[model samples]
Target: MQATTPLSANSAATAPRTAQPVAARGRLITDAPTRMFHWLFALSFVGAYLTAEGERWRMLHVTLGYTMAGLLAFRVLYGLFGPRQAGLGLLWRKLGSAPAWLKSLRTAGSLTAVNWRQGQNLLMALAVVALLVMVLPLTLSGYATFNEWGVFPGEDWLAELHEFFGEAMLFVVLGHLALIGGLSVLRRKNQAAPMLTGRVDGPGPSLVPHNRRWLAALLLLAVLAYGAWEWQQSPKGLVPANAWSQVPGGEASGGDDD
Candidate 1:
């Protein structure tokens, strides 16, 4: 072996350092179940709204409404007891930080300078809350109206409330789209792509390695079965003629008309 002289301090200090390799993109972030829930919720809401226009589509509307409700229930359960990143605790923490986040936004020099992760978290939390506000009232009012539950002052009143909630939900959906567009532009990334692909551009181990897609399939099948059962149980006519027996003048009017 050749003998080498000891390097001087300045020589060692000025030596070229090996740079660590940059991490590549395509890290899994959102889980398959959550992604399925997101898309199902969107499609069900749209279907319900579209079918709400005519009595001919009333059964379809009711089925879609029930589907939406079931999806929301599943989502709530998942958020409470699901994966680490998809839990309610994390969302709550993000929502709680909104005040500080907004204050920081006032000082942020640009979109790139802002804490995009926290900003995205805050927006997602707000969107969840907003969607709940829209969906809960819509589902409840629609169900009561359809089933003639009589929980409201009148069926007509419940119908009006259902219409109002539907309109409000449309507005909320528009706002949600606008927010997504703005965030996508600001972050210089397609925000919706992760929802579709369950992946994001980052370097990290997947939050969901296996995705447990079978669980999502099972949940979806159960919801569909419940919806089918509900549809079959619903009255085929506008109102079951026998349902009018309790009303004083209803039976008399029907008999006279007959």
Candidate 2:
């Protein structure tokens, strides 16, 4: 048997050290229900917007509008009763910090020197608050116009008010999207990923302890049931019979408005 010499300290130190591989890092920052609500709310608004102009699509448009109102109601309830991470009070506090951000802006030597992140957060909060505040009036005016309730003094005022709110909502939606895209580019990270994936890359405990997928499922089921019931209520169906006749060539032709 060959006698082996002990390894020197420098040689042992020079040998490549293999550590137990560090696991891929991530933390769940957004919960399932919040993400589901976010997408559903966005889609409801978009569907309503696209169908706003078409007579044949009026029923679908109305359904989507009602969906928005209902979704907002659910969101309000969730924000009020759910975890602290998803609270309206949190939004209000963020909005309350607006004065501080404004004060910072005033003190800054230039616009670029101002806290852009703080300003961006404030703007985002403003857009969200605007959207939430506007939904009730938007839906109410839409309902009035639909039923010819004549809630307003004149025939056209209700319609005009509805249109105005819709446009304002659209403006806020676009701003919200632009802010996300801009921040994503500037930060070299997808700002919207948290909503999309409900997680952010890092080694830390999840900010949201529970995923609350069951709540999201229940919300989805409720929306679907409502939509199905609405469809059943319409005699001609979700796609009105007028849509087929409206096509210049035939039902086969795509003259159907968005």
Candidate 3:
């Protein structure tokens, strides 16, 4: 190196001058409505489940169930009219894409790239389906018992069917929790915090899409109103030996005794 040389502009530019990190995008992951629904649903489900058998807790259980039903119904409407990413059409399309990808994988053809969002999208769609199934019977059976519409005509299957679906929901909910825990650990992320705080920190390396706000607000309002109305008609009026209550006898008293 006999001659001192000025650095070439290209080389100088290419050199790693102190690495400057990019600022994170605005905190725009989950909106307030979405986050509120998440926690309320969690609380309602747990309270309802724990209070299932006790008369003292029966009112609370019914109230919570009504709240859950209203929330779910509102969610369905919101998903339809919500933000682009939160729309039902987009979510369902993502779910449908999974089967197509699986088929393509079997065919040995060059497959289109599927992003991380696909996995989360599919999981969410499945959870939605599971929830819908669970809620339909829970709500229907509850109404049936309350209104004295026993067996529901030819749909006598509803009684047993409701019990089965309700129990099945427990498994689906557990699976959801496991999936969340696993994803968070694997990605080194705090996925649950966003639902709690209504804001995600960084766009980190994940496919969790953002939610819309207006639709979420509408949903929350609708659910809260419906829940308040339903809670006012708590199941106490229909209390008896029905499955919801603990009748003085070992067995529930209302069903036909043959």
Which candidate comes out best when scored by lDDT? 2
The Cα local distance difference test for each model comes to 0.80, 0.89, 0.66
Tens digit of per-residue lDDT, candidate 3, span 54-99 = 4555666677777888777666776687655445676577667888
Model 1 TM-score, all chains together = 0.72
RMSD of 2: 5.4
Please identify which of the two predictions, 2 or 3, would achieve the higher lDDT against the true structure.
2
Which candidate has the top score in TM-score?
2
- Score candidate 3 by TM-score against the native: 0.63
Q: Which residue runs of candidate 3 sit more than 4 Å off their true CA positions?
A: 1-26, 107-117, 151-159, 201-258
Q: Could you give the C-alpha RMSD of every candidate to the true structure, in order shown?
A: 13.0, 5.4, 10.8
Best-to-worst order by TM-score is 2, 1, 3
Residue 221, candidate 3: C-alpha displacement in angstroms: 7.0
Q: What's the CA error at residue 122 for candidate 3, in Å?
A: 1.9
The CA-based lDDT of model 3 is what? 0.66
Which candidate model has the greater lDDT, 1 or 2?
2
Expressed as tens digits, the lDDT of each residue in 1-258 for candidate 1 is 999989899999999999998767588888888888888889889988877886766877888887888888888889888888778677678789999988988998897878878877688778777886578889999988888776545338888899999998888788888888988898899989989988987766877777878987887788768776876787673243454665687654445422
- In angstroms, give how far residue 2 of model 3 lies from its true place: 46
